[model samples]
Target: MKGVLRFGKVVKLSPRYIGPFEIVERIGKVAYILALPATYIVHNVFHVSSLRKFISKDPSKIITEDVNLQSDLTYVEELDRILEFSVKQLKSRDIPFVKVL
Candidate 1:
């Protein structure tokens, strides 16, 4: 899942559970069939160890936004605005950090 998640410059943070896809049925004692998005070209069936049941606490928190995926399964996050810019002095150099809003 190296290219599974990408957030701006941060690309090493990979999620344990990718989605809360609907379970179509049980394939076997250790396997299950899931209804994944069409954007995913991988197999829908997965092992039970790789699945996690999702329970929504707030129904209004449902995500209805569309995710624009590239051919390589990468999505670009648009930067709204730069809130603040600062520089931190390290041992031998200054590191610049920008806060975006």
Candidate 2:
């Protein structure tokens, strides 16, 4: 229940049992990771509930605003569309393999 996940150091939270998520990229001290495109962490996101603020006054906040959901959807859709279009183009051109535009 307690261990360290490191970009370079250790962060100790009771890491919600909700990830075999993959880290796609990392820059600086932060990581960009992805999970199976669903909302899993249904609660306990805000460590700022009234009781928490009462118990510990460190009321810092970061809001992500569904950026991941939007980005993943866009990425998947764009990739699919690109592949389909490439297939059509290749079929029309009768090209055996992709050549420079």
Candidate 3:
């Protein structure tokens, strides 16, 4: 589902999709009732635009990486290694820089 409700949290930090929940029933042409978890303190009925079709998961196509995110949804990026180092010749001084991966 599209992340519309923030639930008092930061909207940008919240997940885009909460679940691929089972559809309980169709309310009308553009609304549906989902079988949401008991922990979710919100209405079960949602507009069709807010819902997305669940595609079957493919293990071979999945890519996983170890990422440690902070409380504000930020992560510290560490440089693997410096690829190249160069010094630019200026009129009075030389500026040094390094290219990293």
| RMSD after CA superposition, every candidate | 4.2, 15.9, 8.3
Question: Per-residue alpha-carbon lDDT of model 3 for 1-101, expressed as tens digits?
Answer: 35444333445565545546779999879999988655556678888887788776774554434345454434466899999999999999999999999
Candidate 1: pairs in clash: none
If both were scored by TM-score, which would come out higher, candidate 1 or candidate 2?
A: 1
- Across 1-101, the per-residue lDDT of candidate 2 in tens digits comes to 13432121233442223223334444345333343335433222222111111223443543233322222222111222222223334544753433342
lDDT of 3: 0.68
Q: Kindly report which residue stretches of model 2 are placed more than 4 angstroms away from their true locations once superposed.
A: 1-15, 40-101
- Give, for candidate 2, the lowest lDDT window spanning 10 residues: 45-54
TM-score (C-alpha) between model 1 and the true structure: 0.65
lDDT of each: 0.68, 0.30, 0.68
TM-score of each: 0.65, 0.20, 0.48
RMSD (CA, Å), candidate 1 to true, equals: 4.2
1 or 3: which has the higher TM-score?
Answer: 1
